[model samples]
Target: MIGAPMETKGLNANRESKPNRSRKEIIEKKKAMDALLKAASAEKDHLSAFPAFRRYQTNGLSAFLESGRGDKLASSVKHYIQNLLKANMEGLYGSEWPVEERVKRREMVAPEARYIFVREASNASASEMSTMSEQESTSASCVEKRGPMVGFVHFRFVIEEELPVLYVYELQLEPHVQGKGLGKFLMQLIELIARKNQMGAVVLTVHRSNSVAMNFYLSKMRYGLRRVMKFFAKHSVMRLKLSWRYVSVSTRNHLRRFIWFNKVVNSTLFTKGQNPAIEVLEWIIQFQQNALIIVI
Candidate 1:
């Protein structure tokens, strides 16, 4: 009878120990799964590195992607962007933003940034081309021989709303190159890169006072305005949705505006007593309205 009681106690202890062992095994499996996910993410980032060379035949321009954690290169890019912004957005930002301070801030964040430089390709010397096997070295020398830098696009890959996107921080070109369709070419290249990397969208912010830029993005490129926030109080966020085809409805609207302007210009009322300056002001107001249609 005493042996029976002892056997029952032994069975109860074995049952309790089984649950503990099962719990430990479950914990181990969960940890392993977490580690595997982390490793896979890192591998994907490594594999998705941007290509060093891209050529746009329409503009006779070639762009090279410079990506790394190098501070010197980042500084150079920051300086370039700063010059561009000072010329383009100084009025929009007003006197509150000093160029030097803005450049400093950009430099601090640039180590994590990637730059696409517009360069001309030079026929490399035979000896240098034959001796260089490393792509990095080849690119560095190519930049040196390719003459002065004409323009650059600074962008980064980011996750927004749980989707991967390419964010364009700045796209700047020299005054001589501005009207030659290079800006559109650069944006096209950015979209292509985003698509190649499986990004969902391309996003950028434009200053409200920069009407030319706003028109280029909305009417020319068909980027839809996502939202207008008071954070900057003077900027609008624009996004190009990559999942759908972009219709040229905006183009048709612009054509209609042009036709209306021509009709008004030819009208007797416009020529009889109305001042020419008044007509110009009317046209400007209409243009502004068209640009703001997508804002809010």
Candidate 2:
């Protein structure tokens, strides 16, 4: 009958309209998400106003810290981050991470992140030094003119494993700056920031292939490895509990002396063409321990 054809046409029209309705709903949901993210970013910007700048001086070098909000300084910060990563991690991750794509991803997630820039006090210009006190830089040129940035650390405060933590995303220092105790100095500042914010722990991820980083985080800094249930094949997570009593300043000083002593011992052994035997290392450690106790 004629009515049968009409009913079929109506059903087909309804089927077509269903997809349009669903598409409209999806667009509305995306809009809502965008709005929510903007509000959250605003809130984060408000809360990060305290401790605006922390100055760190060590080994005759000075690093000025400033909190970064993703929306405000994403361009300049991303530029620094990209340059650092390309210099440091490109070889480690291989070609799997194209710089352009990686930079884009970092910029997308950077709105809530914090940054510390290590600048040589003697080399830095007035404009570069001004960034130390400013909340956020509006121009990327300031970072560019500061000569080669010596180092940087990116971190954010988050809740993981049901506890508040300060998570370090990346810590990169130039080749010349490495082995000068600047890395440890930066980590100490991060811990202080965590304690100031009442975070329960400090967490970071390391690439297994980067043995130097692994040794630095595990042996030197005393960070414990966490079994990462879901992580990239080459990466591992490390955590340091902040809930316990702070590692005393004396202990930190002892740690620094131990690190310096080991470096000297290794250099001496290598230069003298002597095998770094277990016995020799043990003896050196024991002697250093005795010396530290005496100093204490």
Candidate 3:
């Protein structure tokens, strides 16, 4: 009888300890997430960390990246964004665009919003040609002559599904700049920023009607579908998990040859044939190799 009481007390103690341990783990996770978000938000300029990505020059296209805040966006910049979004996305949204545009305008002005503006460097003024390091080119407040804006990416760091993520709200590029490897370059840089900040993933949404955008993200960028939003039936969430280590390999020659890519055209997510998932793995292997950094 005496031993039975002791056994009961021991069992009760063990049961109590399980919840306590779980509670401790939950608290630790929350603390870690809070710390990650705080650090990410504190950094004023993500592109500044990646000086190499500041300039993308290839295929006769030259551009530079500068950071901006949504709330501080000049009227001209806001107008450009609205027009660009409409130009690129209206066909996909059809009759829903005006309402959606209003929502996007409101979202774009949120204080937490962040932007990486891509500007034409080919016609950059003499002052813009001079090094901006001394003046901190990454500063959102720094006003310098940036050649006509060609593209912009608006993203934010937020917790999604209990994981810290860099959520890309907008990636609008002028039609003239499309297909010049600039889009791929921008996404690569964004993924690097996410990894640098210990984010679990880079998340975004794509419309079903936008086949080109869908193919670009899933096939070229290695993003997988997270899920379809319940309310936004026309949109699907896409995510590129950043926890995976980047594999380094040279794929330029392989891409030029298109030997394997030719075989998988019928296997991708969109109507236009694309390289298959194995091809995606091949891209994953070579993706990091292209990430060259030149800190100037």
Candidate 2 per-residue C-alpha lDDT over 109-146 given as tens digits, one digit per residue, 9 for 90 to 100: 56576666666544554435545544333236544544
Q: Which stretches of candidate 3 lie over 4 Å from their true place?
A: 1-7, 122-145, 227-296
Candidate with the larger lDDT of 1 and 2: 2
Q: What residue runs in model 2 are displaced by over 4 Å at the alpha carbon?
A: 1-53, 99-104, 107-109, 123-148, 229-296
The segments of candidate 1 whose C-alpha lies over 4 angstroms from its true place after superposition are: 1-53, 57-78, 99-104, 120-142, 231-296
| Tens-digit per-residue lDDT, 141-223, candidate 1 | 56576545567776666543323456676777777667667788777767766655555456666655667776778777766
lDDT tens digits, residue span 22-75, model 3: 889768877887898889977888877788887777787867788888889999
- TM-score versus the correct structure, for each prediction: 0.52, 0.51, 0.71
Candidate 3, position 192, lDDT: 86
Q: Which candidate order results from sorting by lDDT in descending order? A: 3, 2, 1
What is candidate 2's TM-score against the reference? 0.51
Quick one: best TM-score, which candidate?
3
Q: Find the 10 residues in a row with the least total lDDT in model 1.
A: 258-267
* Cα lDDT over the full model 2: 0.52
